[model samples]
Target: MLQLASGSSLLAIAVDRFLRVRIPVTYKSTVTQKRSWMVVAICWFTAALLSFIPMFGWHNYNTWNGTTQANSTSFECRFFTASSRSYVVNFIFFGFFLPLLAVMTGLYCYIFLTTRRQLRLNIGAATESHTYYQKEQRLAASLVLVLGLFVVCWLPLFLMQTIKLYGPKIEVSSLFVHIGVLLSHVNLAVNPIVYAFRIPKIKEEFKKLYMRVYHDGQQH
Candidate 1:
């Protein structure tokens, strides 16, 4: 659900960026504004659908084929049964891993471009050229730093999942899953903190929100 929600939000931001660059004049118009919001709504709806299908048992949880274990944890419904392990493995790999990999790949590409631009600007600055290169460099660095934090925070969970999938058949305890999931959940909250504290626009917005609430409370 977090993946779907956060993914949709990120997708909206990307789409907004694309629209701003591709059709700025149209982006400002009422029609375009309505259409943009419609697109966002569709994306969120689709995300919810993706999350609900497996959850609501259009594809039911897998159980060990024709076998009931006496000593095993029968209370826990085995979502990935021994018989369906291969299918579940593939699903996890392609569904989650592939998309995560793709996102990281894109992040790397962005980092590369940002680094290259910063380096070029720094070289120009060293040569005593009059350029707004320093400001651009700072902006680029900030973006890269945020992206790097995202990668750092998420990579550990991905690595843990991948190892459990393909490596040794060590029994995955609930504790491990809980820890990994907690770490992953922290990323969602951490991202907003980073944006609010480190990004000027977000910081200003935070201040406005804080002041608005404080003033409203005082008036009451």
Candidate 2:
């Protein structure tokens, strides 16, 4: 699941970069495809390494069979009830929410900087050609939408986990915890689909990639 999430995140970033800066006629040919590939590779490697922490001893994990008044799911991803409450709260706060917040913040920052530059240069109006200005707004809107959905879906799970940790006195319903996990994992897949279908250039790239594979199969 972590590996898949990482790949989807990287692909989203690549698609975002292509839309915002690289795919414009002015910049597309000059920015080598290899550079984009490298960026994707780095995202994958970094996610893979970071995700190994829970699997390895950095994040706490354990099997819980204790019976409580309000049942939580047997399978908890963020933190185990058996672990230190403070540590669990910190993990949920910093490990998941903080990073997500940072990424979204960065995206907004990029959008802000891009808009400021365009305004300063007096290129705010749409040119006859497809310039970065024309597409960046729509792309930024889409990214904001995507990230908004991500935060909405995943934030609940983190909040629930944090509540369970900090406010241990309050019992959470098992069904709610399970639902949270479902939402978070669902986020892992949504971004890629949005890019492949919603974004025109990305859809074209996929079409070309598919055609190349199909032609190669026919040749063989």
**Candidate topping lDDT:** 2
RMSD of 2: 5.9
lDDT minimum window of 10 residues, candidate 2: 60-69
Q: Give the poorly placed runs of model 1, Cα more than 4 Å off.
A: 11-39, 58-93, 100-104, 107-141, 162-168, 172-174
lDDT of 1 by residue, 177-218 (tens): 566656667877887887777668889999999999999999
Model 1 quality (TM-score): 0.61
lDDT of each: 0.56, 0.63
Supply candidate 2's per-residue lDDT for 57: 56
What TM-scores do the predictions have? Answer: 0.61, 0.66
- Checking candidate 1 for backbone clashes, the offending pairs are none
Question: Which lDDT value does model 1 have at 106?
Answer: 66
